[model samples]
Target: MTSQPSLAKADSNPSSPGEPQSGGTGDTGDGLKAGLKNRHLSMIAIGGVIGAGLFVGSSSGIAAAGPAILISYALVGTMVVLVMRMLGEMAAARPTSGSFSTYADQALGRWAGFSIGWLYWFFWVVVLAVEATAGAVILNGWIPAVPQWGWALIVMVVLTATNLVSVGSYGEFEFWFAGIKVVAIGGFVVIGLLAVFGLLPGSDNPGAGFAHLTDAGGFMPKGAGAILTGVLMVVFSFMGSEIVTLAAGESEDPQRAVTKATNSVIWRIGVFYLGSILVVITLLPWNDKSITEHGSYVAALNSIGIPHAGQVMNVIVLTAVLSCLNSGLYTASRMAFSLGQRGDAPKAFARTNERGVPRAAILGSVVFGFVAVWFNYQWKDTVFDFLLNSSGAVALFVWLMICFTQLRMRGIILREEPEKLVVKMWLFPYLTWVTIAMISFVLVYMLTDETGRKQVLLSLLAAAFVVVFSVVREKVRPRVDA
Candidate 1:
């Protein structure tokens, strides 16, 4: 066995905020360029809050909790805000492409970093397959000449090439893709609200009014407990909210970008998530048969007399899917690049090309993504089901780790360099602990339901295997000074 490296040395203070640390800047470490502009980061942060899940997966939540699903969304939104605050606090102190994983190395241990890093990478690659397939289905519907799998292949290849070219290319594509989503949803909410207030022009369904919120069985139709069930249903939709923090590392000003994204999270969640969902439940009754038949958004549009509502919503949903696929490839590659830098992954993943793009890492991630796409096509129910379930709970795991890491990192920052603490978590250790408890409760709650139970068990199993591998790898690998 190789000698073990001192975790204490790994825990040493990060470099000056301006200087590139192990995982920061394009100097003396990974050659990733600062290609993302302020506008790109702005749109990415705004777009991060809206996911295809909100567009596609919300029907089930409305079906389950009725109008009370609003509470579930608010609860999850609050949790995300708190978690992002903690992450922002750290990222601002010492900006790095590694983001939370690097913080995990400093505050927890190498094993923690290794485990979470790989799990996060696994989650996104799987998501690439999911988003690619989703986009393909929509494209195939629009153009029946191409097979679904052919569309999937074409989408994956195109996005992978965009990422391979430069981080800026990814940002440019996302800027437009996300722009469409933001505009589409924003317009929906405005039109829906106007119709609800009986102010819409040429509208047949005026006075949608607030009655739908309480009329049919009074909000908590399934009972207050259903709110928690709704939480499980809608929680995963919030997955991409943290991608901005990861993307911030590649921007011109990492700390400023991190702080800005962190600060604006609340409003983004409010306007996009809570605001849009409110429009849906209000514009039509939560229990309306059409809500489930045609989806919440489309049903709302149809109620407002919008022609071709299904087709319009499909166009928007397809944009959201493509955006997700683009971001997923970028996120997975960066995480792999970080792991490679720390000697946790193959060294080739750490190398970059002339344009400062992590070509090897991007290709590596896409290769697995392609294999996953194949699995999706070949044995969707058995193999792809396991992949989906095992990666399902990772968002919760990631949030839990952020909460824990913040608790430790706070004191570390104070002891070493207090000024670096620009973005503070509200209520200090108290709110941090509360956030941790809330996440743990959600995990435990997942056990009681059939679908949630499978996701929790399989995700836990996947986590356990990674943790064990990390520990064993630490023992065998040669110890090197940080």
Candidate 2:
């Protein structure tokens, strides 16, 4: 836990207990610490963008929309880029440890910030449960000595200790976890291109032709409806990308970190996601039997000349799972710590150790994480399904708030600090509103579907639960007089 000066500014005092400590480049002493470096921030910005969802779920998009699934990814990725740009603009200017949550408090209101903070925390903690199970399952497959649940417990405990050491330890761990995924995807793209170009072991198929794409019902298996239908799933793949901005708040150079990350997102969406998926569809038939069973990328590789396809993908998927767990722990614990500082959660969460990491917050998140692991393996059919189905819809809520905060923060910056406009959201107000409307429509649609009904219900219950707690806390002690 190598400590540095608190980044809080003079006017920005320690966040009142249970409130987000305004990370004003001036915070100090046991409250908040700077243990992460520029490289960690940069890699987190880059590596965290590619999530396990892309590794595991995008194949469904491919099957549902076929070749045109690429279009769905493009559409969603574009929106994510625009929304993140808006977030980066505000985050670069203020650069608080709270990230979007703090911005919501300032731009929206204290209540809004509190609600979103807890919701985001809840969302990631759910992910921690899901991801930890995923990592454990892979381990169980190889070393059958430990039952799957046992592997899950081992994973959660190890990561908890890693996070306890220092924020940098988590960063270093994530850097490599993310690095492996990057390498795997990068390798996939290269091999995919080689296969497509008639350069691989089996050169029977021609390179870059339309047959694989258009042959099976012309690239829209279920028609335009399916392309749109796949959006729900495709959009989920982009969820973890925003984690970098959340994490940037703690880095050595907050503003610069935000700018670099925001700028790099365009390429990540392009190359890692769009570019790679494009290669996947182009290399193999959209309706290939391997896809539905073996996963799109590994199946594609297997269809080609690659050996050990399943094990290779297993390694990549495991890396992705670990990366998600690593980032999830970091994101959730910070939100808890931020909430504690803001007076919304227990004050102990805000208590930082000598390394400046929030020890209690990390452990608290891990506790539920282990519980989630239990639910996953024990209640595989019922509890885990409910957890996965119910919580994913909330990601839109968090992204929407980020958009809202940026909309208001734009004016705040223009009036007070023009310099921070270093990273601007393209088409500002117009595109911003479009993304919001689209997000709103998705949420509304979630309520209409029969299967989606429960998801929407649980999601609203969660959000409303968080909002109510925030309001009650405010009533208990009005900050104006406190």
**Candidate 1 lDDT by residue in tens digits, 288-400:** 99999999999989998999999999999999999999999999999988787777887778777767788889999999999999999999999999999999999999999
Task: Check candidate 1 and list the clashing pairs.
Answer: none
> Once superposed on the true structure, which residue ranges of model 2 sit more than 4 Å away at CA?
1-11, 15-30, 201-208, 381-384, 480-482
Error of 1 at 211 (Å): 1.0
The residue-by-residue lDDT of candidate 2 on 128-212, one tens digit each, is 9888878887899999999887888888788888999988899899989888888888888887888787777664446765457
lDDT, residue 128, candidate 1? 93
Count residue pairs with overlapping backbones in model 2: 19
